[model samples]
Target: MVRKAKELNLKNNEDFALWKNFLENVGINNFSEEEVNQVDLTIGIFDKQKLLATGSLAGNILKYIAVSADSIGTGSNFNLIVSELIGKLALKGIFHTFVFTKPKYVTSFQHLGFKKLAVTEFGAVLERGFPDISTYLADIKQTENPVKKTAAIVMNANPFTLGHKFLVEQASQENDLVYVFVVATNAGLFATDERLKLVKQGTQHLSNVKVVSGGSYMVSYATFPAYFLDSPNDLIEYQTTLDALVFKNWIANYLHINTRYLGSEPLSRTTSIYNKILKKVLTPEISVKIINRRQLLNGEVISASNVRKKIAQNKLNELNELVPETTLKFIRENAAILKLRIKKGMKIRGN
Candidate 1:
C-alpha cells in the first residue's frame, strides 16, 4: 500500500512538535535552533497519526532526515522522499543540492543521484548537480578575467573589524586576485545585507580584492552549528572538513583560486577547528594561509567577540579601537536599531 505523505509548515505548532518528537525517537538531535526555523521545505510520510518518515531542506542542503523503524528495510521510501525534495528544488531552478549524513546512510543517498564529495569520521557530505561553479569558470576562461593566481577567504565579518581588514589586506597583497566570500545567511546580530556592505567598504582600499556572497555553499552543518549548538566533536570536525573540501574540489578549481586565507583564530574553538580542517583537507594544488589574529595597543587580541562584549557593556569607545573606521561608522549609524535587536535576544557570539 502507498504511504500517506504531505508537506509541513514548521511554523505550525503541531507540525513542529511532531517533527521534533520524530527526530528525538530516532536518535538524531544535533541541528541548531536556527536550522529548525530556517527550513525551506519539509515533508513526511505518515501512518495514521504518526509521522513515519521525514526530511527537510535549507537552501539546497538536505538535513534533519529520519525514518520510522518499520520503513528502514529498503530504499523505496527513501528514494521517494528525496526524489520529491529534489523535484521541489528543481521546480525553483535549484539543480545542485547537498546532503550531510552519517556514514551508514551514504549508500542510501547514493542510490538516489547523490555522489560522495567527501567523507569524514562523523559524516559523509554528498551532492547532486553543482551548477554556477562551472559557469563561473567558463566565463573567466573565455575572457580577460583569467586570474593566474587566486585566493579565497570565507568570512562572517559580523561587524567587519580591524582583524578582518588585516586578513583581507594580507590576502590581496599575496595573491593576484582575492575572492572574499562573506557569509550570506542571515543568522547574525547584524543582518547579512549589512555585513556584506561592511565587508565591501572595509576592503574597498584593496585594489585586487573582489567581495562576493557565499550563497548556501560556505557555512553548513559543520562550522555553523558548533558556534551555537552543543554539537558533538566529531560532527564539528567532519562538517568543517567537508566545507573546505567543497572549496578545494569545486570553487578553487572553477575560479582559479590557488590559495585560501583565514585569520588565525585564537579564541573560538569552532573556528580553530575549521582552520585546522581546511589545512588538512585542501590539496597541495591549493595553498592555505592562516594569518595571525590582529591585536590592539594594550596587547589584547583584536576580536569580534571582544567587540560584541564591549558593546553589551556599553563600551562603544573601546569597540572603535578594535574595528576599522568603516565598521565603527556602521555600528554608530545603526546604534538605535542595534539596541532593539540586541535587546530582542540577538546574540553576539564570536564568529
Candidate 2:
C-alpha cells in the first residue's frame, strides 16, 4: 500500500535531492532557479522510504508532477498527487487551477477534471475548476452589437508606454470595439494591477477601447510561463503556440474578435518569436495586424524596456518622450519605490 501524500520540504537537501532525481528520472530536466523558485508547495507519495509519486503547486499552477512507473498503482498514485494539490488550492480559496504537461498525459489530467485549453506537438495546457475560461469570457462586457468590427490585443505593458497607446489608438480607429487584454502575470517590475491601471489610464480617451486583465486565460503564467522564465527556444515555441491557440479557439471565438493587433518586435527575441507564432496560429481565422513600433524623433523606438531602463538609471527626464503623461506621472510618483525594486534584484531587462 502507498503512504499518504505529505509535504516535501525542498529546502532540505535530502528532500530536494529526492524530488530532483525523481523528476529527472521522469524526463523533466529543467530545474532552473527561475522555475523552482515559483513553487509554493510540493507533495510526495512514498512507500517504505522510496518516493513513489510527487507534484507541486505554484500559485494555482500544478508543476513537476511525476509518478514512478514501476510502483504498484501508478495511476492511483498520480491521481492522489493531483487530488492533494487540488485540495490544498481549495483550502486557499482558489477554485481555478491550470497545468502544463506532456501531450501523452493530457488524457490522464482530463480524467481528473482538467480540460485541455490548448495542445501543441511538444506540450499541452489544461485547466480545472470554476471561474474558468468560460467564466472569464462570460464576465467580459461585450459590445452592444455582435456584428460590429472587433479587435483584440494582448500586452504585458510593464508600465504602458506611448507605443502601447499608439497600437490601441490605431485599433480603436479601425475597429468598432477593441479589447486590450493586459498580461496578468505579476512577475515583472510592475505588478499586474499597476500595468492594467497604467494601460487604462494611458488610453482612457479612446472611446471604443476597453482595458481588461488577461487573467489566466491568455499569456498567463499557466499558458506561457516561458514569457517570464529564461527558457530555451523550443520551450518558448511550445508555450507561445499554446498561448496563441487558446486565443484562437476560445477567446476570439467567444468574443467575436475578428482581428488581433501586435506591435512589431525588433528588440526582444522572446516577444518576436511569440509574434511569429501568434501569426502562424491565429491568422486566417483571425486577422493579424502588425503595426510598426512607435518611435521618437531621435530614431529610438519607444518601449517599456527603455522606460524601465530609464527608471533604473534615475533618468526621469528621458521618459517624457517614451511614455504618456499618465504613465510618466505614475513613474515619477513611484520612482523611489521602482528604483528600490531594481535594487532588490527585480529584473529591469527583458519583457
Candidate 3:
C-alpha cells in the first residue's frame, strides 16, 4: 500500500540528502543554491524506510517533484503528492497554484485538474484553481476600450527607471492602446505594490497606456522562476520559451495584443536570452519590437539594476539622471528601508 504523504523537513541533513538523491535518481538534477533556497515546503511518500515519491512548493509554484518508477501500488503517488501540495497551499489561503513539469507528465497533472497554459518541447506550465488565466483576461477586458492597434510591454520595473518610461512612451505613441504589465512577483527589492505604483506614477501622463499587474501569467515565479534564480542556459531557454508562448497564446490572443515592446538588453545575460526567446516565440502572430536602451548624457545605459546599486551605495545624487522625478522621490523617502533590505541580504544585482 502507498503510504500517506508527509511533510519532509528540507533543513534536516538526512531528509535533504534523501530528497536530493531521489530526485537525481528520477533524472531531476540541477540543485543550485538559488533554486533550492526558494522551496517553502516539501512532501514525500515513503513505504516503511524507502521513499516512493516527493514534491515541493516554492511560493505558489511547485518545484523539485520526483517519483520512484518502481513503486508498488497503483499510480496514485503522483496524484497524492499534488493533492497534498494543493492542500498545503489552501491552508495558507492560496487557492491558485502552478506547476512546471516535463512534457510527458503534462497529462498526469491534467488528470488532477491542472490546465495547461503553455507547452514547449522542454517543459510545460500548468495552473489549477480559482482566478485562472481566463479570469485574469476577463478582468483586463472589462477595463479596456477596444482600439485599432493594441500593444503590450511586460516589465519588472524594480524601481521604475527612465528607460522603462521611454519604452512605455514609445509604445503609447505607436499604438492606440498599450498595456504595461508590471511583473507581479514580489521577490524584487521593491515590493509588488510599490513597483506597480511607481510604474503608474511614472507613466500617468500617457493617456493610452494602461498600467496593470501581470498576475501570475507573465514573468512570474509560476512561468519563469529562472528570472529570480541563477539558472543554466538550457534551463533559462526552456523557461523563457514557455513564458513567451504563454504571452502569445493566452494574453495576446485573448486581449488582441498584436505587438510586444521590449528594451534592448545590453546587460543581464538572463534578460538578453529572454528577449531572444520572446522574438522567437511571439513573432509571426505578434510583432516583437526592440527599443534601444535609453542612455544618460554620459553615455551610460539607464537600467534599474544600476539604479538599485546606487541606492545600495547611497548615491542618491547620481539617480536624478537615471530615474524620473517620481521614482527619485520614492527612493529618497524610502532610502533607509531600501538600504535595510540590502543589508539583510536582498539580491539587488539580478533582474
Candidate 4:
C-alpha cells in the first residue's frame, strides 16, 4: 500500500536513515539534508513488511521516484502507489504536473496527459494540466452529441515526417473521424502553427482527418510544476492513469466514440497501457485497437528521436529514408535549425 509522506511517521532515526540509504543507493551524492527537508511530501509503496517503492513531491516538484531493486520490472506496484498519490494531490489543488525523463519514457507521461518538450542534457520534460481527468471525462461526455466514433491524435508534427503520415493513416483506417490535435502550445522545436501547417500539408490526402489546435482551454502551460526527472514510475502511472480515465469516459459518453486506434511501439507506453486499461474497463460498448508501428527502413525502427539525431548529423538523405518526400522537403527548406544544432554539437565535441 502507498500513503502520503506527511502521514507517515518519519521522526524516528530509522526513517531518516532509510531515506539517506535510498539517496546513497541511487548515487545522489549532491542530495543534502536540507534538500530532503525541503520535500513538501512523499508517497511510498510498501509490501507486507517493507517499502518497495517511493516518490516525493517537494517544493511543488516531484522527485525521488524509485522502486526497490527487487521490484523494478513489475509496473503494477509502482502504478498503484502513484495513483494514490496523484488522487491525493489533485484533491489538494495541485493540478499541473511536470516530469523530466529520457525521450524514450515520453509515452509513460503521455498516458497522464503529459506532453514532452525539449530540454538540455539534464533530461526531457513532460507537463500536463491538472484535474485533466475531470476535463477529459467532460470531453468524452460531449462526444455523445455525435453518434459516430472519433479519435483525437495529439501531435507536435515538428514537420510531419513519414512516420507521422503512417501513424495518421493507420489511425484514419480504424476510426470514423480523426481529429488531429495539433499542439498549439509554444512547446515544440518548431512554431506551433508551422508544425500544424506541415501536418495539414502532409495529411492533405486524408479528408476524414482534420486538424485542430490545443487552444487555451485545452492545455496547462504557465502553471505547471517542476519536472520530475528522477522520480520513479509512480508519478507517470499516477498522473496518466487519471488522464486516461477522463479521456475514456469522454470518448464513450461525450464523443459517442467507443474505439480508438494507436501505433504500437516500445516508445508508446501511455497509449499501450491506456488501451490495456480501457479495454478491461470500458464495457463491450467501447473498444481499442493497437496498430503495429510503422517502419521506414527494412528493419530499423522509425522514431522522432532518430530523425533528430539524423538531422544533427546532417544526414539529409537518411532523413528521406525515414520521412515522406513532403516532410523531407520542408525540413530541407528549414535547414537553419538543423545547421545550428549541428554547430552546437560540434562545439560540444570540441569542448
Among all candidates shown, the one with the greatest lDDT: 2
Stretches of candidate 4 above 4 Å error? 1-147, 216-233, 267-285, 341-351
lDDT of 3 by residue, 1-351 (tens): 648677899999999999988888877677777778889999999887788999899989888777788876536887788888999999999999988777888998899999999888777889999989999989877345567789999999999999999999999999988999999878889999999999999999999889999987875533354422223546777877888888899999888999999999977777887788889898888999999997777888899999999999889999999999999999999999999999999999977
**CA shift at 207, candidate 3, in angstroms?**
1.3
The candidate maximizing TM-score is 2
How would you encode candidate 4's per-residue C-alpha lDDT over 189-295 as one tens digit per residue? 45677777888888989977867665432332222222333554444443344444444544335555566555565665554565565455554765666667676
The 10-residue segment of model 2 with minimum total lDDT is 221-230
Compared with the true structure, what per-residue lDDT tens digits does model 1 show for residues 1-351? 557779988889898888887787778665567567657899997656666788888878787777777655435667777877888899999899878777788888888868886666566777788564555445434225667878888888877888888899888888788888888768788888998899999999998888877765665444333211234645567667767777777778767788888888778887788777778888588888888886777899987777877777778987877888888998888887887888999887757
Error of 2 at 151 (Å): 0.3
Q: Could you give the candidate ranking by TM-score, starting with the highest?
A: 2, 3, 1, 4
lDDT of 2 by residue, 120-191 (tens): 887888999998898888899575458579999999999899899999999999999999999887889999
Off by over 4 Å in 2: 220-233
Clashes of each: 0, 0, 0, 18
TM-score-superior candidate, 2 or 3:
2
State the lDDT at 120 in candidate 4. 30
For each candidate, the alpha-carbon lDDT, in order, equals: 0.76, 0.87, 0.86, 0.59
Off by over 4 Å in 1: 6-42, 46-52, 57-61, 64-73, 86-97, 107-111, 115-117, 127-146, 220-231
Task: Tell me how far candidate 3 lies from the true structure as C-alpha RMSD in angstroms.
Answer: 2.9
